[model samples]
Target: MSCPHVTAIAAYVKSFHPDWSPAAIKSSIMTTAMPMNNSNQVLKDFAYGAGHVDPLKAINPGLILDLSEDDYVNLLCDIGYETPTVRKISGDNSTCPSLSARSLLKDINYPSIIYQIQLMQPFVANFTRTVTNVGFANSTYKASVMKGSNININVVPQVLSFRSLGEKQSISVNIARGKFSEPTVISSPLIWTDGEHSMRIPIIIDVTQT
Candidate 1:
């Protein structure tokens, strides 16, 4: 039901931005999605990832986190895939680099963030993301985080200014575990707004004892 609807929306978005990559299209849909349900309650990531898709907003997402084929190859290599296996998967002579999967995962430029940590342990996770400007040139976006009480989240440089279309900006988010009573999943939204457009991405932290 939702799958077909989302697929149609993706197609609709792709029709408008023919040059956008699949990852860019996905980011557009996810970032522009509605965060609340009809009942006016906030949607959970486990149930409604990135909330409901909005086709009209998806057409112009303002900024998109785009990924290239090389990015996929790099991810595979970082995940410990053998050189031969990666080459076969990429259908090219792609080689593996000596990179850590943990580090690569944080920098993948995906529209969402998820981290798992031990319940009683001191935890700090950092992620870096880059977004490309697709909206108005000379626009400035401010970063804000809606975090849970059990963690502290910080975004560096807090502001992004794009001078021209296709310009790219990178930001780093650092999360540290705070006092908590028990193991739980903390859900937050890291949003970048330019007064006109709001780009939201979910940041999920899983705290487990085991």
Candidate 2:
């Protein structure tokens, strides 16, 4: 059986990027990891969660979904923690932000998209992401998706243009869930390519039959 305790990749990445946060480190490992099987085919999520970790590619992940401390705090509170409970967990007396200020889990800055399917009902989720340019300047990246199941996936601003290094761009992933006859899961890739480097993010959708 494959071990679920996989921290070597994250630890290795942290050694080089000590300043990166936990989320960034995880994103690097997952976004750059291999999703292919020994036969060179894309493996399902049940087989591999973002596939095998690649140390080299992870070090220079073209883009990262950066999150701040406040983002996490808000995430916890949004999930139904009162102000005092949040303060206790954060080891600080910070008060919870107003409901209007809280961001949903789907809005968290994650490199990949994950959604819980609503049985017998179609749903839509929009995920916002920002990527900093670590590659060459004056480059444009085009977005593409490997179709999976019957979901309708679209990325706004299909093309990203960067004039200088370290420039950040925003991307919105709009996923419209499709009805499934049975409980199942589907996987796909949301890729951004500059005709040279490809930043691939594995997208997983879990469906349940009601």
Candidate 3:
């Protein structure tokens, strides 16, 4: 049987430039990272560590996540980098016109970044949320669209809508529910578009989901 433990490590370094792909990520891991063998120990430590914070519920029954990767962890509350949610419409939802999510990101100083999915990938220690953003262009300028998520998901447009324009796509990450076992992998297929001089944003998400 396959193990249920999952660990993910991410690095936004100069070598990666602005984009990445799954095949490339796989190759990278094989060359640079070691395959995890002892999953239970990590999971045990994470739960104990988090439980220490809340003494009252040290043994609270919940999902356990044990993730260890060479790159720095993307644990919440510890990251200087973030995708914060802002209220774009204070008025009524009916009165507030629906704006593209990309519009929100273009206003900031973020660069062109893309992420890929890793199928059957498992991870630990996480939360869940949904967010939206909006932006306006100057005279004769084009406005961008934007949305937000901790991780990007790949599914049919019916389930996971890929990002377009200047907006980021939304993902339903199990990272929040805290599912940890033995090498939990979340799988994300590669996504791309084609055209003359078309910009192919390669996103590599090497995860296992089981």
Give the top-scoring candidate (lDDT).
1
**lDDT tens string, model 3, 7-79?**
1222322134234333223222222222233345533222222111211111211111112221111222123
State how far residue 64 of model 3 sits from its true place (Å): 23
Worst 10 residues of 3 by lDDT: 133-142
Per-candidate TM-score against the hidden true structure: 0.91, 0.85, 0.19
Kindly list the per-residue Cα lDDT of model 1 for residues 47-166, writing each as its tens digit: 678887889999988999999777888888777788899989999887776655333767888999998787667878889998999999999999988744457899987999999999
Task: List model 2 lDDT by residue over 1-210, tens digit each.
Answer: 334445776777889889888887777777777776634423367566777778888877776667887988988888898888988888888777888877878878877787878678778888888887766888889999986457889999899999997798888998986566667677778988787667887778888665
Better of 1 and 2 by TM-score: 1
- Deviation in Å, model 1, residue 115 alpha carbon: 0.4
Lowest-lDDT window of 10 residues in candidate 2?
37-46
lDDT scores of the candidates, listed in order: 0.84, 0.79, 0.24
Screening candidate 1 with a backbone cut-off below 3 angstroms (N, C-alpha, C), the clashing residue pairs are none
lDDT of 3 at 9: 26
Q: Which numbered prediction scores highest in TM-score against the true structure?
A: 1
Model 3 residue 7 distance off true place after TM-score fit, in angstroms? 20
